[model samples]
Target: MTDATLSRADPIHYQDATTLAALIRKKEVSSREVVQAHLDRIAAVNPKINAVVTLMAEDALRAADAADKAVAQGAVLGPLHGVPFSIKDALDTAGVPTQRGSKLFAGRIPTADATAVARFKAAGGIALMKSNLPEFSAWTETDNLVTGRTNNPWNLDRTPGGSSGGESAAIAAGMSPIGIGSDVAISVRGPAAFTGIAALKATQGRVPFTGHYPAVTKRWWHVGAMARSVGDVALGYSILKGPDGIDGYAVHPREADAGADHIPGRLRIGWVAEAAFGPVDPEIAAAVASAAARLADLGHDVEPVDLPFLGNPLGALMTLVFGEIVPTIKALAAGREGDLHAIGAGIVATPDPTFAAYLEAEAQGEALRSAFAGFFERYDVLLTPVNPMTATPHGAQELVVDGKTVPWTHVMAATSPFNLTGLPALSVPYAFSSEHLPIGIQLVGKWLDEATLLRLGAMLDRKGGLDERRPAL
Candidate 1:
């Protein structure tokens, strides 16, 4: 499609956070006015996209008034003061329903905010709404009995990607300035890529996951920011990072240098063209390759690298995820047969696995982690496809990758391994496919070294100029 067509089809939503904050700081716009603008935008576009499942209009107006008060009093303002943001429905918001896209807990509301939500509020962010997610945040497509499905803002027939799909869809449609999304796997990255937005999955534990449903008992789960710009992600991360007294898994003696920013220079970037893992969708691969070439043009040294360990990253991830699931199911089910979600019911109906089999899967995961560690030794950043394909149509619970009728879990293969290894990764829009859907490229970085990745991503963001293209909604 022509640039003009894409522009008219899906308009970019939300101004840059920095710019918006500055306007608030300057009194050019009242905090209430800013919040209302977003609220109105959501009302205008959300019905077409269905990304936002819950609105907090009253709470947001109150917070906006407080933000305006702080500015009037000359009170020290947080970096995100008066900025409007959103969270995936899976993240808890006190008093606001967090259905988690599951009928299991349709009206559930938390008594407290998720760690990331608290941080965002503490930074003076106004939480306007909650975005959609897959049922129990387990699927790649955002659909559940509670909130229904979220359509791609660019095209109603296509998906927005999930379990963070709602956030991606909302951001892409200009409903929210920035959003909070969790990544146990590709939930954040995949959706961001599919929707052509920017997202970062900080090294696991960088952001506390406490208070999120499906309680992030696994240390590999991550909470990060999603936005239209890298700088906004950085600003959101700055506010959201650090320890909450409640989460023992939260990173301590934080090694991240908060003030440091990535400076461009000659750097080593590992480009994974192919591996035994499977074939990448040709269009997706081309987008990644094009991104690599753009990085090379920006003076970085890019080379193709081998990632043999990822041959069965999905298998390892399934073992790890299902290992956690078995117990969660038992607890959520509470011995009540047929009470569980359909997918959960299917999972439990299968006969219990032999202990030997469980042990073998765990062993395989450990081995895969070891290989990723070795791979990182030779590469500062690893660039690959976020998903083997672009966003699939809404309601597709399963995807066919490389002729294998894989479960939704395969969508997270490229991402979950990094989560397992505790590495940082970012998903940036690369190019559009033959069908005109956005394709995303993944950039994985060393553990806790998001600065380098963000810097490289910023350069790519500048060079690829995907930001210049907006979807018509």
Candidate 2:
């Protein structure tokens, strides 16, 4: 890499994928140059956070050269032509190792690219690296026997938020501008929020789950696009949203809502900061409430409302996800228990969840879904903090927030409900904690209404509060 490219002063390292693609298309920056710049970035930073586990350096460079030739020859190019993107390790990449954070599958390779990955490549985005995740993509921190641990770039001692932690860390650190992450509970949005970036988990089935592991999470599972801007995320989602005909979860086609952000009048924004997600940090709560106030000041009607069904949204989600996943994963790990991650092994060894418990959880989930649907009837969107606190320490058992020791998944309180209800939710970076950590707010919209969530997210994006901050590392 050239000295110019290696310098942190090179703004290309921090530019969004859309901007990078535009730059390449305009011939101001060659595709090879863009890819190499990111390679240099990863080489310099990956050692610190271990965000990217597998680097496709040679293939990415070759692809970038072909992209440049296509551009030079005046060939029609896709929207993301020549842009570099990171893939979460759980997703399959043909000819690439996709260990999914387990030693049992250490040398495993895929015969085909995951649907989302193929769609990204078809759109001219190069998959430059595979980001790490917890074993089986099941935890709140990114660490496993395969890739060690992925630390938060902001503070090396803190976590980057998980399952999608490595993806978010890479994006936040500018190793890659956009990536894909799966969220069954709080994986994608929580990590995005924790890392101070933009991310959206569209309604269940909006994106396919065909090429990823832990297929059992399919009931409420979704693979979402994580990017630096709401539009970039919307753009990623636009390309990957249609049914791939493989993942049964991907049934409905998203409607064209290109104009979702062009609001003709003030929006009705309902917000809840305390009751549903208990005892949130004052700073976190203040950040979200302030965002609501900002929108209200901009002519929208922002009010505090209580949705009773959210009383135990996380509890309901846990019951449903664990109930369904325990059996499926247990069966998959039948003979390979010793090689699995500790959490995975423990899950498999645990007693099977009862059918009655599954039924009851499903019933509670339906009621919550119906209640959220009614809540949306009275509001255009709902707003709240993405987590009760900022990122926690690696392997943290609990969090001391507001003078109380809370479970690490307190971050899921605001995000998991949307996963359970299959409603669209977007996480936008709005503020920084006193320690200079990122704090994000969640914008929840009606079912399959990612367009509206993006609309609200765009409004927040314009503020660019988090853009001014970057990891010191």
Clashes of each: 6, 0
lDDT per residue for candidate 1 within 293-408, as digits (tens), equals: 88788788898877765656556666667667667766676656454456556656555556777787677767877887787677678888888877777667677765667666
Candidate 2 Cα misplacement greater than 4 A, ranges:
1-10, 256-263, 462-464
**What are the lDDT scores of the predictions, listed in order?**
0.77, 0.85
In order, what is each prediction's RMSD in angstroms?
3.9, 3.1
User: How would you encode candidate 2's per-residue C-alpha lDDT over 1-473 as one tens digit per residue?
Assistant: 11222234446778777777787888888989889989999989889999989999999999999999999999999978999999999999999999999887798999999999999999999999999999889888899998899999999999999989999999999899789888988899889988888888887888889898878778777898998777789889888897888888787866744236545657788998876687799888888888988888878889998777676778788877787778887777888888888878867876766788778778888998889878877788899888889988888888888888887768788888888889888988788888889988999887767777787787886363565667998
TM-score of each: 0.91, 0.95
How many collisions between residues are there in candidate 1? Answer: 6
How big is the positional error of residue 214 in model 1, measured in Å on the Cα after superposition?
1.6
State the TM-score for model 2: 0.95
- The alpha-carbon root-mean-square deviation between model 1 and the true structure, to one decimal in Å, is 3.9
Candidate 2 Cα RMSD (Å): 3.1
